[model samples]
Target: MFNVYITKAGKYLPNEAVSNDEMEGILGMINDTASKARRIVLRNNGITSRYYAIKDGIITHNNAQLTHLAIEQLYDSRFTKNDVELLSCGTSSPDNLFPSHAAMVHGLMDNRSLELNSSSGVCCAGMNALKYGFLSVKSGNTSNAVCTGSERSSTWMLADKFNNEVINLKNLEEQPIIAFKKDFLRWMLSDGAGALLLENEPAGDISLKIEWMESFSYAHELEACMYAGGDKMDDGNIKPWQDYQAEEWLKQSVFAVKQDVKLLEKYVLKLGAKSTKIALDKHGVSDSDIDYLLPHVSSNFFATRLYDALLEEGIDLPNDKWFMNLSTVGNVGSASIYLMVEEIMASRKLKKGQKLLLIVPESGRFTYSIAYLTVC
Candidate 1:
């Protein structure tokens, strides 16, 4: 198989940065009351500023538009839109359910028709798209491909979306706030897009040589931990959005993102470390092989916990060797790892032969995606 290299990386972080004090204003306050969980969530996530595609409840860029903008920035003298043979896009918060996210993104580009692949998942969706592009080029099916991971999370975080749920809870004489499962995510997610251009040859003075990409799913052993478009039943089964009546949709807030925090606390880090150890062992990669570690963490609350988990697995990488951008960019779901890569590449801090390990944990179903890339 031919080797695939990341020729360039680009990102688009919607409008100006929105500060912590401004988030509720933009997303609006549910029931005209401040979110009891917002400050606590933000404090733990450690995100001071984040961008949004919406301003004053108006969307400036849909998910497709954000993805398209990031892709447009990938073109240069060595690569143009016409040179793209494949377009793969991934997102959990897509604009529509009918047209695939990749299709919608491809529609925005003024280029010839090309093969499209859209990956559907939470955080790992981005890596899945990257893996698809990497393999497409490695297999010689395409000489070049563009892959993107993006999220327009603000669209779903709007307070109005939860109004019905709050009202329903009030009528039931329960605490008026939405469940912590759904309300906490409002302060954790951000809107942004990041893209990678892959080709048979490396571009510029430095490029990332895709060594190997591996993914693990513990779904067989674990129940869903994070989800949307469905309601979690008491039996731990997910009742899909389509299964509910239209009125029940708004009443239950079935479409709003939610997480089983207890499940996340129990399995997220443990499964991630387990999967990472397995990947490293399968490839004969040791802790010393990793020059830099890029991990996509949903909240900084898990940062030190993640380090400890990795140590338990015998991967002894230090804190300094780790690279993260969550504080500045917030958690962009599938785009988080891509954004981390984009900034690191732009920093020009990597040296030849240096190895970077990217770990993305998806609480959606205890999935983990680990990839190794070498600077060349």
Candidate 2:
């Protein structure tokens, strides 16, 4: 049987750092409104700063360039163009609807001659894209593949739009709940990119053996939490999700203005833990077999809730054994798990012969992906 192993992990975060103060200032927050919101973000997410592709109040790097930089770092001298037989990428935001992010990255790498796959949707697209690449290797279609996930989340956020409207906790009773609810996540979202070079046979000194990978999407029955849909046209009429007659979505702008926080808090961790248990049981992976846990909890508050839920399920993972950089990176959409893997592997925290479970739960599309990795 063929096996796929992650040979190299790499990540790229914008050099431009955005602090909580900077975020509040950008949103045009005034008086104590910014402080109150900042406190909530800090208390809930434990994020103080995150990098962005913005410069002088303008977005500089698009999704494609970010992914390219990450992949470039993955190449390092160990792997070359010939070693990469397939390229797969995924993102919620893209540079262009055509050519696909993978094709654009292929063009950037000057590897137009090779095969590429680009998928677009919500945050779960990243996990799906990697799964596609994993299948590509397990099926013997390719010996090596480069999988990438990148996002310029700042561009898709609408914090600046609701800056003046957000009320402070001091005036909690004075404003509508939607105002604070809508503003909660936008400020915490940041930007980054992550890439991984995988092969059937290990090429580098370290490798993460692919033991099990599966994704479960439960959004069909759940209401959309955060999304990018049709914005208003010149006449102020909202376009449909996709417009076939016009050949364009007419989405002059797509942003998240509202989210169901109650819905998210209600089912996110419970469903995520259930999915984790399912994968663990299916693969016969025991709690004792796991040496590390990499969980991409979108918010810091969810982190505690998820920990409690996992404990109830009888999987007690210590805090030190869990690796997360959300405090510095925020929620990077599809790029979250990739960044986790890159940081973990590069930090030397992963020794040979350790089993790690990567838990990725995306509220944007109500999906859960649990990947069991054996480090060697």
Q: What TM-score would every model get versus the actual structure? A: 0.98, 0.86
Write the residue-wise lDDT of candidate 1 on 210-245 in tens digits.
999999999998889999999888988999999999
Question: Best TM-score goes to which candidate?
Answer: 1
List lDDT for all candidates, in order. Answer: 0.93, 0.76
Candidate 2 lDDT tens digits, 21-65: 677555444333443555766677888778888777767788888
- For candidate 1, the TM-score is 0.98
Candidate 1 Cα deviation (angstroms), residue 47: 0.9
Which pairs clash in the backbone of model 1?
none
Q: For residue 307, what is the lDDT in candidate 2? A: 89
Q: Clashes per prediction? A: 0, 0
For model 1, the stretches where C-alpha displacement exceeds 4 angstroms are none
What lDDT does candidate 2 reach at residue 358? 89
